[model samples]
Target: MSEQYEYVPHRLLRHRVRDIASGVEGELMAVVNENVSESGVEHWKELAYIRNASGREFTTAVANVVPT
Candidate 1:
């Protein structure tokens, strides 16, 4: 069977971004896609990991970040 999905690195990787809701600014460290299947349906949830200047890290939805 053919593959149903393709995995690609997010454009913001290694770039600086800020969370729109929390006003947190940091370097984008990684992008993670979590696949969810329910009732024969499948979808992906994109998440981002960021590290701040002070070395603090946090996780947030990819949609919440904007280029800094």
Candidate 2:
């Protein structure tokens, strides 16, 4: 297990971004990120580690994930 956060306020994100140009459907997972990057490239700067509905851990690009 990478890391699991429960009962904590976090951004719930699902993998497999539809608007993705790669056309890759990803797994369902939660995401995490830094508050604000000085470079302003923070959105796509890093990946947010998350766990899918199936209880599988996964990581996705920041831009590829959205808050739910």
Residue pairs clashing, model 1? none
lDDT of 2 at 50: 56
Model 2 segments beyond 4 Å from truth? 1-45
lDDT of 2 by residue, 1-68 (tens): 22223322344444343214333344544444434434544332345555544555655555655433
Query: Per-model C-alpha lDDT, please?
Result: 0.82, 0.44
Worst window of 10 by summed lDDT in candidate 2: 1-10
- Per-residue lDDT tens digits for candidate 1, residues 8-43, read 498988899998878999999987776655666777
Q: What would the TM-scores of all predictions be?
A: 0.71, 0.35
Kindly report which residue pairs in candidate 2 clash with one another: 16-26, 28-52
Error of 1 at 3 (Å): 15
How much RMSD separates candidate 2 from the native structure?
8.3
